[model samples]
Target: MGITLVLMLIFIDSVSTFSISALTDSRNSTTEKEGKNADIIRSLLNQETIIRMALQQNVHILRKDLVTIQEKLTDVETKMSRNQVECTSAMSKLESRLLILIDENAALTNAIRSDLENCNENQLMSSMEIQQINQTLAGFDLKQDVAFTVGIAEFNKTWNSGTLVYNKIISNIGNGYNANTGVFTAPFGGTYVFYIAAVEYEKQDLGLDIVLNNKSKVRLIGNNQAAYQTGTNMVVLSLGKGDEVWVKRSYGKGFHSHGVPLTTFTGFLIKHV
Candidate 1:
């Protein structure tokens, strides 16, 4: 409001000054001549008056625009403040969830250890231990056996041999090994560490392609680089029994095998349980 008053006062002052200048010019031209030059001067004075009026009007509009701009700036600042508060709140909630997950994982690990001590030593897994596994294998029968097209052994049994124990296995794959297929079925409910080895460790490192049952996929190694000898790139996926594991190789590429010449390799599931 105070700024509007100042702008109005400046406009009034400019109009008064222009009026005085026009009066002076008219008196001077009348005293000199009432002829062609005088008419030209009159026309010039009129143009100058029109220009001054337009400038004054533009100045008034500019002041109004400035006020509107200030209001918009205030609104933007308010929204920014609210978004900052929301982001802070979300971060705090996520941090709380992380702490809870860590605690739950620790408790579950302790419970598993206690049960393992009381179980039979030679038995791979007690019937009670497989209850959770059955839950994972829901809608599928554990008593049934699945046939293999690629691998020699029923991997489910190998993977679920023991609750706490996992083994590293070497299998025959491709022309070197008897089994040659893109698909491998999981025998048990545990995670399996699938590794591929190089024949001479000098072959091109055209990484392996691992496809999961749920259509999720990951590349073992990348293109153009040789496979890292003895380096294991794996995923800890929560897969149920009877789930399929596959290795698809591009560029006629295959993974390394153990000292035994299997194109693809298999082993124990590496995990906490």
Candidate 2:
């Protein structure tokens, strides 16, 4: 019994030691698994921290670019406002200059119109004056015509030195000559021409004188011994209105004979002053 007790004690000791060893191995394995799980969780926490830091940096860059863009927009708006103001000022000045030019042009046009009116008035007055002068000249031309031609029908007689009378009238324009007195009266102040002609009876002397205002101006004589002697005289004299011209016998008594009424006198006005 003692020996069997001793064997049983040995067996109990060996079993107890084996059980303790197994329990220790099991505990060590559990601790190793727990350590590996803790390492994996730490790596995941490190990656999450790095990603958060990158996101913060990108947000900061974006905010700076937005501020720069806002500043550029504000500067452009200010420049545009200043340009608008300058343009408005230039337009106002140009409009004022145009108004001034229009006023000047209107004033100049008025002045030119006045000058033209005055010129037309002056031309009208000149035309009226010219018409008056022409009318006066026409009147003078109508009044100044004076002409006369006279002759004697019978002249076979002798007479003393006296005025010769021409009895027959051929032409008497303006009635300037008297057929009974053989005298011509001037109708206007002008130059006058007179002609006297006489034919003496066969071989007889004839003396005739043209008298202007009772003054002898020319003489016609036929005293030579020639058959049918003839004499003629012409005189030009300046005569006033109412001046007289006549033919007269100067020295020889009249043996003046002409069957065809050859004794003649004529007077006419040449020009008027």
Candidate 3:
């Protein structure tokens, strides 16, 4: 009986040791599976963090580009606005200049008409006088009367806000004109007829007067608000021997005479006194 009891105790001790060994192996397998799962989860978290950082960087670059584009657009708009204002101002000035030109053209047309009428009257009167003289002097020897005349088509000179002189001569008869001094010195006292035509450059107001012996006789004005303008004047005067006649400009204004025949002065002795 003592031998049987000792064998049973040894068998119980062997079974307890087997059971503890199995439990320890199962615990070790569970710990290894948990570690592998934790490693996989950490890798996935790292990939997610990298993707988030890349996305944030792209968004920041996009924002900066948008700001730059906005600034460029603003600059372009400002330049366009300035150009528009300048264009509008230029158009306004052009319109004003056109209007002034129209008015000046109208004035010139009227003056031309008046001058034509006067010329026609003078021609008719001359024709009538010639006819009368022919009829009165039929079959009679007639002596020609002494006559003097001078004319200039262009001045080709410059004058500054004072007396003007015509230096160009077209026709001089009876040796009565001095082109160097711009004077018509009457050889004898007579009834004299004088006429003047003038043109000026753009944007200039030309105020001129026909001066007889240093006295203003008739005034002529050529307005230069247009591209160019013309003016004319006519006068009849009774003068003594050696009388002087010339042209003078108004005060505080300049006059320009192009090389062309844009200005003229003419005088003739109609009859001796």
Candidate 4:
């Protein structure tokens, strides 16, 4: 019986040791699993922190860019407002100056118009005075400076006793003498002096008369057979306008020498009435 008890005790001891060992192994496995769980949790926490920091940095950069854009917009608005105010002020000043210039121009135009009116009145008064002066001088011989002198251009072989012609003209201030018809028509009522000269050189006697409206006024005679002889005469006449006067050959065949224009007729108005 004691031997049986000893054997049973040994078996009990062996069963106890095996149960303790199983308990120790279970504890160690539980501890290892806990440690692995702790390491996985730490890794997840680090990743979350890195993502949050990156989001914060990006948000800060966006805010700074927004501030810069807002500042630029404000500055542009301020400049535009100032420029608008300046332009309005300049336009107002320009309009005021333009109004002043227009007023001044109108005043100058009025002054010029008034001066022209005064000048026209003075001109009218001067013209009336001139007319009165001209009328007063009309009756008193206004010194009519009328004159003419003519000569024969060529010497003819003989001249018939009708009218003598002076073909060459030295001066004809009044245009009263006609070279083609050899006549002088009085241009105005005047007192005139006349001179006539004649030369005879072809052994002939030459007689010339100053005729007034077909009436004889004076005579000039030259007679020479051996040398040239000249006869001259002068007369003063009071002639009416339209009276005709000329020189004529007196009643015979005559030879008159001319070429230095020696045979000449001259007349002048001494007084005009």
Best by lDDT: 4
Q: Per-residue lDDT of 1-273 in model 3, one digit per residue for the tens?
A: 899999999889889998999999999999999999999999999999999999999999999999999999999999999999999999999999999999999999987786566556545754664576456445333332333333344332345555565666666777677777778888889777777766665546777788899899998776644434566676778989999888777632544455556577777766677
Worst 10 residues of 4 by lDDT: 222-231
Cα RMSD to the true fold for all candidates: 29.5, 29.7, 10.6, 24.9
Tell how far residue 103 is off in model 3, in angstroms.
20
Taking all chains together, the TM-score of candidate 1 against the true structure is 0.32
Across residues 177-219, which tens digit of lDDT does each residue of candidate 4 receive? 9999999999998888788877665646778899999999999
What is the lDDT ranking, best to worst? 4, 2, 3, 1
Q: Judged by lDDT relative to the true structure, which candidate is superior, 3 or 4?
A: 4
Error of 3 at 74 (Å): 23
Q: Report lDDT (CA) for all predictions.
A: 0.50, 0.77, 0.71, 0.80
Q: In candidate 1, where is summed lDDT lowest over 10 consecutive residues?
A: 157-166
lDDT of 1 by residue, 174-227 (tens): 221123334565555654444432221333444444557636355543232222
lDDT of 2 by residue, 1-273 (tens): 999999999999999999999999999999988888888788778877887788778888888888998898899889989988999998999999999999999988886676566446545754664575456445444444788888887766566567888888888988999877878888888977787777776556778899988899999876645544567767778999899999888876665655457788888776785
Residue 233, candidate 1: Cα error in Å is 45
